[model samples]
Target: MTRTPAEPHSVPAELGPYLREVVHRARAVCGTHLVSVAAVGSVALGDYRHGRSDTDVTVVVDQPLPGRTLSDLAAVLTHPGLPCPATGLELVVYDAGFAARPSGEAGYLLDLNTGPLLPGKVSFDPAESPAFWYVIDRSVAHRCGLPLYGRPPRDVIAEPGRADLLTALRASVREHGLAEGHLGDNRVLNGCRSVLFCRTGHWQAKRRAARAVAASEERFRPLIAAALRSYERPRSAATELPATDVRTFLAWVAERVGEAAGR
Candidate 1:
């Protein structure tokens, strides 16, 4: 048996070219050290919305690369010459050994967040970072990832543990200032998704999951409606939601998710 090359068409057209460029650049830089590349988040879940999503790619390496190789890969992957399809790109690199482990803290070889919110920066040795959110990321990738190269996602990534997911959810809400969380589309939708994951042990796309939570729980309707509208028209000033309502909604979600975790 032989491994197949990545199918460029696996990603949406908006992200296809950029992703192809990334794969080529990574292969050029990492060579045999690079194990696999997979697409996670909305891109893999088949609910990606153009102009409102980030292209998320995870590349696995056989082992920790030499600093020079890691730096080279970062330079090519985060180069400004390659424009992302949407807000930005989130490209993470992981070690194949750690990724294959059944359970433990996952180490990232490199993590890059390039988008409107922050300047394009690449980091090395992210094992000590408190904001390691790979628990949910691994879960999503294991269940719904779109492979670009090497083995399937389930072959490389382990299912995230429940305790880890709850901790990540708490950290997310806490960073959002609990009751005073921002009312941006991502913020609201993520809050809804966290709540849903806690309750059902399943992951869902932002808008659909938000709608589901809203439908099941009447109290979340107004906030979820505002979030859906914002998602539809992200740049429209006309869609700004009331801050007070957003605060209350965040508080409600935080409380509910906390309760769910306790169960």
Candidate 2:
């Protein structure tokens, strides 16, 4: 059953129906709060190289839950005959306060002063990002769609004003990064975005825009130096900054966090 991901048995063909099934199951458990759901990850991005890709479905609730509650949501995602590496799912509850902070959609965190999901306002404006990240790929943006709540904004995707088919992948990216302490999100997208552009080269503006965020090239110095030096370079060559740079940013972020706490 686990064949290399390629033509003939392309992932979408095999996973499309299976993924929809999982979403249905998730919807059943989520009830009113399951505002949206979709297929993400290797399948969504058309890059399931070999052996097992999880079907990451995101459910944005009407209310955001504490980090601990998200663990409970993880348990609910598992069920029989699921094809994903594990019935993996990402659950984000809407809270205006949290939405106002930076976060990653396709796994890139940002600094949001507004925008919350689940019973809160979730803004997807590209203007708020500091030079670190800015452009919003339609596909990635599509993944942020609140399907359960109804369709998402039509303009944020690749084919401006066209129906979106990439939201599923972006939604999964959100949770995928969160699950792996964000190593999965950041590292994965650094490469994913690269391939994405290779395939959808038309949206140069959006790709370049994301470069600002990916500019944290030094964000995972040791990790990047040791692992894959995957670079998504439309905006900048930030995939290879020294690891120490990332550490410095982290420290700065920590101080800001502390300042916020003190106030």
Candidate 3:
């Protein structure tokens, strides 16, 4: 079930004063014309696990900052309430006017123009960054966003050397071969996109499978065990090869979209 947003949309005791300090730093770095800043990831989702979570927030300015705004805010960032050496989950800044402008369709999953960071723009950047995939592979619904109104964001338009990415996702599938682990990873990635892009109901079945992957390390453990079994047959605890099953597993993932598309 979806949880209610914190009572005040603005910062409150819930985030503690320390995090607010980060917001202030973000505001100064972003300047006064910015639109909104709010917690986004595990912390915002209320799914954060102490020590396991990093702060995720978005700072929307009146216009886009030069680049890597994090570098500027980094100096002023600190907090006893959250943790030290905070990392990942950026404090992105963008101008409201630009955010509202429409970015032509492309490969990116979230609409940059209207992304959580900008709030009203549309972008088509390929969204191919490794760190971007990392978050999608880990959390889906938690991060997938929908505008309260207006059309949903589109995926980055870059066709990322489709043959290359597919070859890689497939090679990894064939070699290491863990149905559940990779499936879960794919699920999270696709699920986040599906939800962010407003395709949830249409892709619900796949999302369900992705959720299972999130919980099944043992099923996936077999892949690593298979590698071990190769060298230490006698000592190997693995029962059989996942080669055949991995193919089928991948097929299931691929049926949806992107690299996993078994086709």
Cα displacement (Å) at residue 45, model 2: 3.1
Q: Please, what's the RMSD in Å of model 1?
A: 2.4
- List the candidates' TM-scores in order: 0.90, 0.36, 0.43
Order of the predicted models by lDDT, top scorer first: 1, 3, 2
Which window of 10 residues has the lowest lDDT sum in candidate 2?
111-120
Q: 2 or 3, which is superior by lDDT?
A: 3
Residues 36-72, candidate 1, lDDT per residue (tens digit)?
Answer: 8899999888888776677788888888898888887
Cα deviation at 18, candidate 3, in Å, is 3.9
Residue range with the least summed lDDT across 10 consecutive positions in model 3:
148-157
Name the candidate, 2 or 3, with the larger TM-score value: 3
Candidate 2 lDDT, 171-252, residue by residue in tens: 3334333334333224344433432343453232222323533455555334434323333321122344444544443444
* Clash number for each model: 0, 29, 25
Local distance difference test scores for all models: 0.76, 0.35, 0.36
Q: 139, model 1: CA deviation in Å?
A: 1.4
**Cα TM-score of candidate 1:** 0.90
